[model samples]
Target: MAEDRKAIVPVWTLATGDVRAPALAGGEPMTAERLAELRGVLAVMADVPIATLEAHPLPDKLDRSRGIPLDAASPLAQHLSQFITQSTRSSLTAARATAMGENLYRMVVPAKVAAQFDKGFICSMAAKGTVGGIRGPLVTSTGRIAAGATFVPVGKAAAAGAAGGAGATAGVAAAGSAALTVAAPLVLMAVAVGVSAHADNKRQQAIEHITELLEQLHEQKLEEEHSALDGCRDAIDKATAILLDQGKLGVSLGLDSAVHAINTALGAADRRLARWQTALDKLPDDKPVEIGTLTKSFPGVDEHGGTFRAHLELAALAIALKRRVVVLQAVDHAQSDPGNPFENFTRALRRDQQRLDELESGIAGVLVRLSALELARQDGLMPVFTAGEVDRLMRAAHRIRRLGDGVTVNGRTTDVAIEIARNKDGSVVVFPALPMGA
Candidate 1:
């Protein structure tokens, strides 16, 4: 049986992060729309600025500016701001899922392990025509095998026991339905580990998977693909009996490796995901904040480099805040997808959006402290922000001194406040919560 598996499964591996999902009939078709969406999602992850709204370029890119891109006169520009922001966030979420999926694919599920089950599954399907269950199918079969087997389109149950592969990629539902459909049905799921890059496991996924396979053979019904896998749990517990008794499972079956892969991959992915979070969800990092061991926020002066440290840090932060404002403004003007109820862009943004005043209040507070950096500027030292940026920051600074009344924070409030500025070194100054001083 183990030998049969080697030949049944393909020699696919995700170490390179390039995954060609198992071929569904139409040969894993990439429709123009899906391809475009994929490109836009990729661009968001790469930090590529959104360049155009014209369908000619394919997927709509996420613009950091969040404001107008080409001539504002174009009707689409006005209509597109909302679409851009919605797409921006959606693409980002998808990108994050993909990164995490790819990372785990590379670190956890070995090509051999995956091949073993797939191979076994293939052989079973060929001979008996089913898989009672497989590891990362981690997916609960959509429904039971009975005449009235029922399951929600989006299944919520995890397959019983047997939780092995930790870094395996899982799906978050299909890409909101693509115009092009693949032949064989497909499902994807993801899990985070120690660092949460979300290590969701109990009894290890292996334990969980094994448990499910056990159930399927007994009182449970197996998926069409799952039934042929090894065998029915005894007609009830047969597969489990075989797993331990007959030792039909391949080689070492390395249950321990799955846990290790989840841990290591999560740590690595945590760092990578942090970078993405800083640039996307939060303020962008123009540079890394490297003030000789100081936290992201430059703390108390440690004897030396007082004013000079303040000068550089403040300038960088000021530039970043200004850039943030520009993007926020774009988001403000952007519209929602009113036509497509399926996209749910409008409801999503409305549900998640912070009040405009509250959002701006964060910017406003940072603008005030950032003003001090302008005063610290030394002559001819190569200014941090550009001329155009300076003009915007300068104007924004005026509102702080005049119209900006002092902001007061209630000591008990836990509402999050964030302000970030970046230096050319790619280091950043991130200060969360209230504190305004120009």
Candidate 2:
């Protein structure tokens, strides 16, 4: 029996931030306490930007000219604004699923795995010609022997023998015995042929039965394929609707040039940070940027070097970018506007800064997600085989893995082979080969 084929499954997760900027004053002097606080915030926002968003849910909503609300702590507000931003993540995933159907799921399952499992079935069936019963015909002979028969016509055997005398009688007995011996073998031969023919017919019937079952299974697979295709179409429609909504949000929020602005801002910040460090470098070799060592809102001020001011500014920007990323991701919320026109190039300027923040924040989160995805991808397709049957699977997986060595994905070469492993509970596992140079 051929083993069921395996499929390549890619792991997928939502990308949280692609771009971001923390809330820091453009030309503010940094203090040891402020620098430490900024670093702490950036670190916290990396995994869950809930704190950052809660602190400054919407930067545009704030009075940018008035500067960051450094004093606004949890005591002032009952809840955090980050939660509001995070809520959008769920909305977007749902919307994506609704619009894309299998497309969205395909990202996680991968085209390979989907194809394999789509046609693969796990079941037990008898081999061909193994069903039904076989039997041979029974032979029997009715018995009675005639005695003292004569060859000549004499009305009856006993009378003929009597008239012919002893010689005639003996000849008549021999002739009767020869006749019975010849007829017995012929009867046995005919019975043997009949039994052989019956058994052949039964064997053929069993083969046909098995063939029919196989055909039915094939037809069932075809029906499923049709159903899955329909689902894909439905998903496309939903995705289109959501895309339109996102476009509208883009127009309303002025997100058209957000990406460009983000890049520009990051570039400027990078340059400013560089220059600030250069200035501090001229002061003395012994002096370094002493922002702080504390993990909380403040750091130790043991070494008082004026470089702390510059350090604070740099740290603050990192935090601010981190916050922006979270806000940007929030715009992707599917519920906000399914098919939002945000993708509309003409309306990029229409996207709000809040949306920009979400997108930027999403970048970082996406990086982490991507790393996890890659690891999951390495896990290859799942197994659906039992331990005892592992060695008996079809060679499809091995062939595919070998093909992968010479094949390229997205233009990158890999030497990964697919190895199928089975467990005792009738489960199958697929292991990807190590990359070349690994």
Candidate 3:
């Protein structure tokens, strides 16, 4: 676990005093490309006036509170402290982004999908006349059956022989044929009921699977992340305390030691937040959906539910990416620097915002697909989803879309994200993003 935390941070980390929490930690350091960016931060810091806030009035973006670096410092110590400050913003964003998907899929999608299944199965029976198709035209598609649509007699193909034999002349033969004709529709209905039952069972299993996934994400990964983040803070606090107490003389004396301890702290924090790593990564992200939650214990969901898995993966990734931007935005907001100190940060934000635009497009497309989905087309026996079913699915996707937005107090940045938590209902909707220490 300790080693896991060390690998996520790039050795060289800084971004014009606008460093994002996740950006400081990732799969690998962009040291080669970001050298110039680091130098730029140093230049900007000189010109910008900075302030320290041990606690902010606003909700901490990742829900981790930061310990301020000593206000007065050596230039080297001062510059390095920026890394500590960003690291202080923790893994709550990752946890929240992850929970948004798991909970939405668990609590929302399965129930809605199952309800559609029940309605479609009923429609199928009516269309087959096991229940009466002629009671009223059993229209599977929207409105009533289209004007010239071809009609197949509900159970005609399957029951043809039995119905035809009813005209037999011999007394015994006629009696038997009449009985077969009477029993045919009943037999067919029994079969459809069995198939529908089997499908419903799978849906139930999927809901259970999703529930377990949500539980593990909170109980395991979230817990581990908080513990690891605390480790990072402890390392930084020890080193910074020395720098704070000794002041200029300490930098002149034990400067190298302080720098080394700070570096150790940064490395740990980075690894702790590498949500994308498959093996030892403590944080949460989309890659795990393929490897774990989305695929696990969902029966045919992974195999037959291609569209289901795809939308979920996209939703989870998109929301996490948005949270990443919000964390960066929060960091940028934290710096009390005058004028614009972060052209690079703003450019990064713009790039992420554009990617989100692409993701949301994908999200919207699937929503349409879900809204129009016809189990009748997919399974032949079930009918088209009812309007209510479509609405339910659409509502789930829309809520997931909101998580991608994150909370934006400023009206101007509306285009930047989906609306995450609204004013008071946030706690009810958003799962706890971090534990106490993180």
Candidate 4:
């Protein structure tokens, strides 16, 4: 996996009353004492090798004669044009004209340098601005900016075979086959008991009961299809052979067209089987019925009977019924609802919805904070830096070997040993060396 690279731009603020003079208690020039304090702060900044990018007012189309400075005397002023050009190249051209009245300036520093400046310089100056002490001429603040990417890995061609229309059709066909395989024998057993009748309510009840049982069996088989789809197909072929053998046996016993009855039952089972298979297919994999409950639901048979031929016929039918029922019961237990599937699904959906809502709210808050920061910059209460300028400075510092391996920022030590590499398949991976101590 390729680790996402986030562009981190360090931002600082300086309060200047030039743009919004009325916002100040009184519109005043730099006092002698205040100017001395500001000079001291600037002297400390000059010692630091960090490049500063100052935002300047540009002439609009109405005032085209007022051109920007071609060269700067100060080191901070020297980087202004370069920063603007870099920002424009990096698709931040709109930022140049977005804010008109700000006298804000930005500095691009390596994380290590920023950390040192904040701790060794800014804190000392801020501490001097106490109630009983002399107030510092400059008002300063600092922040950082970051972004991330998410990647989803794609599987191989073999995995792709389990998706798309062809896979779906094959799944339906297999389910139908499993349903009919288990259903055919059970239906025959019901018909052998002469439960298929017209007008007799008891016979109708028996037929309905058999149909329900077959449906339940079909569902179980379909669930097993996830793991034993091929096995179910094999079982279907064997069951078909057994049905044929039973029909021949029925003929020898003088039963009238038992083969025809078996075929008729298979046809009827196919019709209802498809519907049950479809229903089972829609069910999620996680919801499975209890095996114990399914086992208890299956009908058991006694071997006691009349004449040898009659007893054999009855026993054969009973055996077929029990076999199909056991298979069906297993299928049901493996696939059917262990608990309320719908309720579980609904609860999961609600939780996901709530999570999405929370994420949306969090993102909105970040955006609002960013907007407020921008407004502060425009009002000359904050300083701004382009991400490109920050990246360029970091790269240059890295080349010169001026930056350190670690630095303390806001009372926390942040290591710079994180390495990012890209794979041949285009995925990015990140490997961060552990810091000293556990």
Candidate 5:
């Protein structure tokens, strides 16, 4: 019999001032169309146990203690304390789940979309709270009902009953209205609490996401720094190797040997020039001297003696020219020579000097590149160079020039400079120059 009784369901409409249920079973004869509409409305209701006024216990009086001003000190403090209490009372697992959802949303959503979602969510919460406060519970029932019977708005139930051929009761409708008015504010309060919790969780998730991104960026920067450092070290090693190899060559055949050969040539030139000067002094000032006597075999004569013969001929012409060319030829012979003694020495000296210049230029180029790297680091264009790496590069550069030190090359110590000078007798002396600040 209970199942035979046509069930009356309620539908709560949000449209303004429309809170009535259709009649069912014995009201102004219900039409098939109206019944179908009523059924359609009920079809959307949540599938749950219908709560009746008699079956469910209602609070005797509203608890005003739960309403605002949690503390007597200050209104602000009271509000904050109530908020904190409510947040603490929320399910921790739910809050964590919500936080994870928010974090995921932030990671995937564009900033503009996320911001819009936040605004829309807040507006939705506000609307829900307002609607819950005004409309109360959407459904209520008043009769013996089966378990899991869905309920709808009181107005919808009455309208449905009327549509189903039932006469609507004014007393029941009034009671339902009163019950909804009382329940509305409480429902709205619950909604507000849930929304507030969601908002707080979203804010925390945003903070966590920002922190995660910052940490990732820091790690990336550290990796870049290490890469730049490795690059700098590799560059330094390559540059150092080049300088070391060049330095070995320099120590072997560079400044030291070139200077020694030049000095030796200068000494021989000085001796020949001295002999020519003596021969010129023996020639009569007014007579043409026989060139054969000057060409005759002389002690210490060699292939390199051509300069001496040229100087002698020049000196003889000087005797005829009244000693005018004496100092000219002597100075010219001292400065340079195209013969064996000085020519080979000049060529070797130039070659070594050019090599030294090239090596110095290469070293300078390496330093320029290094300096540019440092500048880039300083300007934040590249990763910073560590102090240890910089110091190591500097040390390597310093050692480059000294690569052949303590190592003999071609039976001679590579760390020597040749010195050339004239004695009081106009004879040239050549010796190794001492190292500076030795």
Candidate 6:
């Protein structure tokens, strides 16, 4: 019993700044002081609201199960590790730039100024400038995680077939398809002549239903985008009406004030949306749909109660909303402007610009949250390779590191990379990259 107790491992470890809280700390376990310290750091960094919390003591060595880096076997690492590595590389490059800047300063500056200068100070500033220039969009691109393939479980496909048959009879989302299953195989065997007919009908029905839903989603996105555009236009129009009415009322009423800048911004919004609408109109309505093919391949085979499409549709809709939001921003600027028309509209333009800036700040947060949501759906869709398979790939690739040798799997050029490296805690992790085309 004592041996077993001593051998027990923790399930996980949470890192907070410099401190780590293991699930188990010896046999004594984690203390309050350590937890409090972790919570304090997290509170400051994340700005999380917490109840009155206390501090905790730290643990020395953490258990293997409760290690610093969790989920060493995650598929996310398999598909996204390279992107993370790329991001890390970008950071390193920026750091190098900073280091280089200080070197340049030392090279250029006089000795008297140089003697007083901090080590690597000039290099650091130059590196910062270089890094800052490439930071934002580069980071975002590096963080762009995507799933390369989709898989459906056998049981789910069967269930979908059964449910689809039942739904035809019952007209309900969760209806059972026992009747169809019972009749389907038997009906085909009884008459070979009707087999092709039955299969064709089934295939057509499946395709129709899938395509119909796809069209519906597309239309919904369009409507939402249009609604945002319309709202922006309405706001601008109202502000314009106010300005014109006041202009008639005279300069004393300040009606014509802030009018031109507001109108100019409104005009920009209208033009942008008009261009978007025209582009959308050009896309053929009969174009092939994505989810439809997935559905057609396995009719009525929706996992998570069709939640997958719902999530994807929401992402599409959100992007569309954001596109329209650019126009909405112009509307906001015009409506919120407070400058007089005769004064060259500086104050109003500045105020509108500030509002635009605030809108941009909020947009990034919204996009990140939306992306996270989209990524969360991946767990349900992607197949996870076995640990042995991951290990084999990683070890095989490790021998060829920095060799620039092309890796081919099953004779196809593979863009994916296998990372076999020690993590912070000295444990080996296998990080796989998305397929090359991916």
Model 6 sits at a Cα RMSD from the real structure of: 30.7
What does candidate 1's lDDT look like per residue over 1-438, in tens digits? Answer: 011111110011111112223222121323323323433343233211111111111112211121111232222222222222232343432233222111111112222222211110111101122434321211011211111211111111111111121112222213332111111000001100110110111112223343444343342322322232212112212222222121243325432333233233333333433442343333323532222322223322222223223322222222222222222222222212212211132133333323322333443444333333221222345758667655644553453233223333211221111122222222222211111110
Instruction: State candidate 4's TM-score.
Output: 0.16
TM-score of model number 2: 0.17
- The 10-residue segment of model 1 with minimum total lDDT is 183-192
lDDT for each of the candidates?
A: 0.23, 0.23, 0.25, 0.23, 0.25, 0.24
> Best TM-score goes to which candidate?
3
Give the residue spans of candidate 3 off by over 4 A. Answer: 1-318, 325-339, 342-344, 373-438
* TM-score against truth, every candidate: 0.17, 0.17, 0.22, 0.16, 0.18, 0.18
lDDT of 2 by residue, 204-234 (tens): 3333433443344444533332233223322
For candidate 6, the 10 contiguous residues with the lowest summed lDDT are 151-160
Residue-wise lDDT of candidate 5 within 285-342, one digit each (tens)?
5543322343342221122223322332222221211111111122123223312211
2: Cα error in model 3, Å: 48
TM-score of 3: 0.22
- lDDT, model 4, position 159: 10
> How many collisions between residues are there in candidate 1?
64
Q: Write the per-residue lDDT of candidate 3 for residues 1-438, one digit (tens) a residue.
A: 011212121121211222212122122333322422422333333221111101101222321111121222322222222222332333332223233221110001111112211221111211222432321111212212122222111110111112221111111112211111112111111112222222222223333443444444444543343333223333333433442222222234433443344234333423322321222223233322222332222222323233333224323332332332232332233222322323322333444344334433444443333332222111234477677655644554444343333221211210000001111212211111110100
Model 4 stretches astray by more than 4 angstroms: 1-71, 89-102, 108-111, 114-123, 126-438
What does the lDDT read for residue 372 in candidate 1? 31
Residue 305 of model 3, lDDT score? 31
